[model samples]
Target chain A: MISNEFYSQENHGPYELYSLGDFELEDGGEIPDCKLAYNTFGELNKAKDNAIIIPTWFSGTSKDYEAYIGEDRALNPNKYFIIIINQIGNGLSSSPHNSPDLMSMSDFPNVRIGDDVRAQHQLITDKYGIKEIALVVGGSMGAQQTFEWAVRYPDMVKRAAPIAGTAKNTQHDFLFTETLIEAITSDPGWKSGNYQSNTEIAEGLKRHANIWAVMGLSTEFYKQEKWELFGVDTLDEFITGFLQPFFQMMDPNALLTMAWKWQRGDVSRNTNGNLEEALGRIKAKMFIMPIDEDMFFPPRDCEAEQKMIPGSELKVVHSIAGHFGLFGGEGSYYHDQIDKHLNELLAIPVPDKVI
Target chain B: MISNEFYSQENHGPYELYSLGDFELEDGGEIPDCKLAYNTFGELNKAKDNAIIIPTWFSGTSKDYEAYIGEDRALNPNKYFIIIINQIGNGLSSSPHNSPDLMSMSDFPNVRIGDDVRAQHQLITDKYGIKEIALVVGGSMGAQQTFEWAVRYPDMVKRAAPIAGTAKNTQHDFLFTETLIEAITSDPGWKSGNYQSNTEIAEGLKRHANIWAVMGLSTEFYKQEKWELFGVDTLDEFITGFLQPFFQMMDPNALLTMAWKWQRGDVSRNTNGNLEEALGRIKAKMFIMPIDEDMFFPPRDCEAEQKMIPGSELKVVHSIAGHFGLFGGEGSYYHDQIDKHLNELLAIPVPDKVI
Candidate 1:
């Protein structure tokens, strides 16, 4: 894989590695010496009914989900055993930037949402020997994997919260993601998926940052000068000082890998493009949560998919932060709102899978 | 002058050029010798009271307004004298790629919206000797100029209609335009705006095209497979064949110049950034038209600005085409609605300027 100093364990703190030993991807390629980086909280009790899985989002690591965990939080450390799994291609996981063998850089196999979910499935069942999960939850790409978990292993996941994401990625979203990919790949410093250092692709990274600057946050966020909430005094500073450099630190190959998979997220492929049939297979108590202003995953798109799932409820959370509200970036209110939704879903007793 | 073959008279048919001698920009830069490209239809009545000025939008030319000039159209050639003036930096006019002498290529001055209106006013007043104009109308960047015309020369413009644009660019829109600029400049081939041919910067143009693919149209347009209306069979074709190539034909420097001005459009600048005070100066009967689904100028954003303009009407047009509806790309219903609004505005007689 393309070795970039940025994606090393030295940069990201306190995450354990679970080796899949050359994991075969659903697309017929394998990540050489594949490893899924993860973290655990609390402990599994007698029957392991208290297990919860928190899948990481795009560009996120296992450690990024710490905001959602605490004794007082919905994902209570004392009450449930929580596992934070970083999806493949998110740098910390066996990604284009961190692979150690023949499959490296752009040669890294194209991974799908299904592949990511299957890997998590393998880790949860084989490593922990847990037959059932109390909850499977995540936001954005994590949400896509959560949908995959519920649909692929219906009997295993009792409750699913796919927040701010969709099972079948919309055509518009595919194009949006295409722009993100174009931003990096088109950079001359990219050198056809091989670059010396992150600094070389500086201009391209800034372009990617501008794309996010436009679509990542809701229009209301800009209209209200909400960057002020983040202590950014001027719009120029918001771009140069914050967004650009934050993204500049990321490996271009890592971003591209995740973006490619994100654009192709489609659980409906399991049922020959019949989303109705695919979502119908979900036995999990599903709460499809969408942020109202999320331009990436608008509430209507999430609601459409939610309608396909039997007994699923569409929960629209309010936030001017848009897709970024998932990270509780500009608003603290969204954090409480998300916790409330999670607690409500947890409180509903899921009917045990009938054999 | 860079002298690209694509923007030559050999390509776009039948438009005249007017010399401005030397033009001074609002930003304190100067073009050695400037020219404005324009087209006119019908005969100016003896009193010159039937004249109408149509300013071109971003990346658009004078010939592009022909769709609105049919015999039975609201801008019926038989009834009103129509002049379509291509804005400076829009390739056909004096721009980065087409200028001659010291102000050639990237050395071209940073022309503002006011500079464009001032040039148009000079052309109309000096050559055409047009006074007490019946109407001034445009869409998008054209709409920006329309607002400027109404504010800068209120007594001259009797009726004003600005469609799918704002009096001042919003912070999000500012950032959105920034991405469009980044797409081209970030390309190594761009060479700081001195690329020899459009083909040299193919990757950057493609990136710019992808950016448009995301924000230029409504998500509903994609959701409904509306590209079918344009005879496209697949999503990939719609992007690669339609969107990408359309932008590829343009000069990147020309696009950048227009986009820079577009992001800074503010009639309120005349009043030291007090939008209400600036818009209040308009004596022309005004109608602000916003496409309901326009992501760039959402009706809410347009309505907010419309509220500041005294007696101005906010007419929300229905278009799944989003901001591209200004060009009538996917729907003709918007054209009919736009014409209906124009005709309604044109029907209202102007109050005599008390000179």
Candidate 2:
């Protein structure tokens, strides 16, 4: 097993693990003594009604969500108690990297967005004694989970903001995810998910990063030389300095785990594959926001799902950063737009009486 | 070294090797006794002016072009002496797979599209005693060679038809090529381009095919389930039965060699990085065709370059097969269009006297 320091909360702190003991996966595999790593800010109010939940995206930990959580941001910790839950397969959570031998890398169970939301539901309702969430928000795989929460437990989620992600995986997105997975696993160093060290799979990780460089950002990003904003002059410098280093630190198995879940993300799976019927069950004040330049989750795809969900509003955020725009890097124009829409969703009136 | 049976003319027949004797590469490396394998159909006319040259694309052999060369096809053997030259790095030619030890696999020099065209010029002008080519046509990497032929020896090529390819590699296409190259090299079984057998790098080759599946075809291909036309019921079947088997037969090093050439295919490099100046040198009657659904070489990119080339016409082939549409499978709608265009190009009036 790898060292705990790689996934420990020592650096990006204030994390807690909620043990779910022998959690059952959607695919019928079980993770013995399963635990979810999460971070919380502010305190649950007297009524336990001011709690907001944010799930991490693929390859992202709860700590990565800190940028969006601030006094004046969309996920204001000052206004509500914010709980950032790391999705299973993210190293910080119950993932392939940190699990026991029986549930380790090669043996890790298949997890879906539904399973992650169910675990988050357990953490919020059973552990924290929270009856309802003020808002459930995220982007990419996080957005997938947000959609799951809205449909799976409609009454429990008052408002839902799913940014730059779809309720279901499109064929194009599935193919893209397949390429990312193949890029990692095809590395002989991967040893069919039994590599000794992350360093061994360096070339594969580099290829994975290259895939992201092409699809994660729009062509406009390269044409405009947006890497200049990231302090890189050439594409090679951007890939080596930024993309390579970031993905190199990650466990390939953990990434594969999240990617599998990402590929299988479909709210309609819970309702016999009837997407319209599944989306119609959403009682939350829904804000379906998509990045205009995002190749993976284009606005056309988001608006199609939004039109099916009763009372759901489709908000498009325009930026050359493409899907990465949702993460809100320095000088990102869409951050304010996302903040405005999220605030609007949060302000929607709910029933004064508790359920 | 692996057996020559895989690349021999016995199975994929009628090919002959032409020795170039210590060919010099654009990257300053040299291959001693360099040779190119080619197949010719029909007899060279008395005038020796009816020859049409077709260069192979990435992973394609001379035999693969046989499908488009029949009595009623675009490359009719009866009317024109069609010379199908296997691009260097394509196994039958002077590739990493078949070269002598000093210039084999890891030692093979980086080849450019211009170098291939220059060699083809030598083969046509010196070996065959052909003064001018009636036409130079191809798709994808083959199209890259067509562009090189038109610009490098403008007077030698009477007409040029480059389909589903660009004169210069776009940032998007360059990134795609990078992924393909990385996918092969990252395979530990690849052993730094010295794998003992094709089976050793199976995973990497499979990944290479997967990338082609995603980018080589359009979203409509998956949505419409066009693989069904290939007699597969599921995506897994399509991948395992079709994609894997197709790529498993090739040499990884050979693929990488061709990919490097594909990535560096910029006619502007010959004209001091001035694309307009390079395109202006084209004396060939040019018909630039792009596949509408091709994500790698979109029609817009092709049309932009077509406008820069003097006397060039842009023709868009609308199809969901994307880049693969150029190969013209069973019941392909665009094959007739391509045939009609090629016939029209062949019918164009030529100078009364030869140069």
Candidate 3:
């Protein structure tokens, strides 16, 4: 078995774990002693009503959310009690990399965005005694969880901000994720998700990175030579130094697990396959923000979803960085836009408590 | 060794080989006893002035070009003598699969668009005594060759039609190709281009097909479920029956070789990296066509190149099929547009020879 250090707070954190014993999955499979890794910033106010939840994206840990949170950022640590939870299958959580043998790798139960939101609900309510969430803010797969939180438990989430993601995974997005998963599992060294170490599947990981190079960012990102902003001179250097190394440290099975969940991310599942009906269920004050250049989740797709959610507002974040713009790379211009919109979202007055 | 039947006319034919002993590549590498696979439709006229040349696209053979050649097609056998030449890396020609042991697989020297056009030029002049091509037409990598033929030997190619491709591969397109090549190479069974039989690299090929599913076709294609037109009901069936089987027959190294050539396609290389100067050298009446939904070679990219080519006309073929529309699929609506354009191009009277 791989050492727990791979998922330990010591190596990749400023985080803590909330253990939920023998958790049953949405697909009817169960994990023995399920745990979720999460980190919190700022302090809960006297009424404990200022708490906001930020879920991690695919392959992201709680630490990956740190860049988006700061004193004066969109996710201001000072103004809001921020709980950034690592989604299951992100290695740091109860993922294929750390789960019991029966529920590891290829055998890991199929997880859904709703399941992650349910776990987040358990963590927030049981651990912190927080009945209402001030907001749920995230981008990409993180945004998927935000949508799920609003639609699945509308009363619990008072406000929600989903950036660079849709209420449901579009067919195009599902196909994109499928290609990414195939890039990893097709590696001979993958050994059908039974590889001894990540090094054995290095080529697969590298190929996975290459896929991101094409789809994770906009075409204009390369045309504009934006890799120079990341301190890389050539495409090869960008791939070698940034893309490859980033995925190499990751567990392929964990990525597959997250990808499977990402592919099935549809709030409509809760409303018996009615997308508009599901969006209608969200009573949260919704802010749907999509990046203009994000090919995976275009602004048009987000705008369509915003129309379905009652009283939801649409904010299109313009950036040539594509989906990666949400990460606040290259001087944080996009981050500022996100911050500006999020502040606007936070400014919306809370409604009176209903019986 | 894989059987030569894989490259023979019996399986994919009506094509014949033209031998060129000890052919030297533009890169200074030599292929001993080089031979090119080609198919000629219709006999050369007494004037030898009605001859047109068509170069095969990536992974395509002369046989694959058969669909676009018929009695009433854009390339009419009755009116024009069409010689469809397979590009070098395509298995039907001299490829990694059938090359001599010393220059096989990973050892196959890099081939370029200019190199393929040069070989096609030699075949036309040496074999058929055809000095002037009435038209040089192709799509994708074949279009790259058409651009090469027009610029590299302007006097020889009277007119050129490059569809769904560019004079130079865009950074976005290059990144897309890199992911494809990486997808195949990362396969454990690839064994660094030394894999035995196509079956060993099945997963890699499937992954490669998956990438095509995302980028080779437009989002609208999936949104409308156009795969139904291809006789496949589900995405899995579309992948297995059409995508996977299509690429599995070709050699991985050949695909890699073609991808490398596709990435480096630049007419500017002929004019010391001055794009405008190289495009200026194209004395051929140019008809630059690009697919409207082709992510790899969008119409805007084609329009930019068209402006550079002196007096070049831009014809955008509108299709939700994306790049695959160039293949004349789904009742060949796109092909009819190409045919109409080519008819207009052919109607332009040839000028009298200047003394």
Compare the candidates by TM-score and give the number of the best one: 1
The local lDDT score (0 to 100) that residue B235 gets in candidate 1 is 78
lDDT of 2 by residue, B58-131 (tens): 99989878878889787888889999999988898898878878788788889999889888888888798998
Q: What does candidate 3's lDDT look like per residue over A1-355, in tens digits?
A: 3443456666678888899778888888787788998999999887788999999988778887787889978688888899999998889888887877887777778888988998988998888989888999998999999999999888778899998998889888898999888888777788888877878888878888888888888877877788875677887788789888888888888899899999999999998999999999999999899998887787877888899999999988888888887666755777788889888888998786532
Q: TM-score of chain B only, all predictions?
A: 0.97, 0.96, 0.97
Expressed between 0 and 1, the share of native interface contacts present in candidate 3 is: 0.84
lDDT of 3 by residue, B1-355 (tens): 2543466678778888998777888888987877899999987998788899999898888876787888888789998999999999898788887887898877888888888888888888888988778999999998999999999988877889998999988888898998888778877788888776877888778788889888988877876688765677887787788888888766888899899999999999998999899999988888998998787787878888899988789988888888988666766676688889998888776565321
Expressed as tens digits, the lDDT of each residue in B178-248 for candidate 1 is 88888888777989988788888898888888888889888888888788754688878888988888889
**Relative to the true structure, how large is the alpha-carbon lDDT of every model?**
0.86, 0.85, 0.85
List DockQ for all candidates: 0.79, 0.51, 0.67
Relative to the true interface, what fraction of contacts does candidate 1 keep?
A: 0.86
Candidate 1 lDDT over A99-202, as tens digits, reads 76566776788899999988988898889988889999999999999999999999989999999999999999998988888888877789887777878889
Question: What interface RMSD does each of the candidate structures achieve?
Answer: 1.0, 1.7, 1.3
Candidate 2 lDDT tens digits, A213-315: 8788876677667886556788878888988878888889999999999998999998999999999999988989899878778787888899999988988
TM-score of 3: 0.92
On lDDT, the leading prediction is 1
Ranking by DockQ: 1, 3, 2
Clashes of 2: 1
RMSD of 3: 2.7
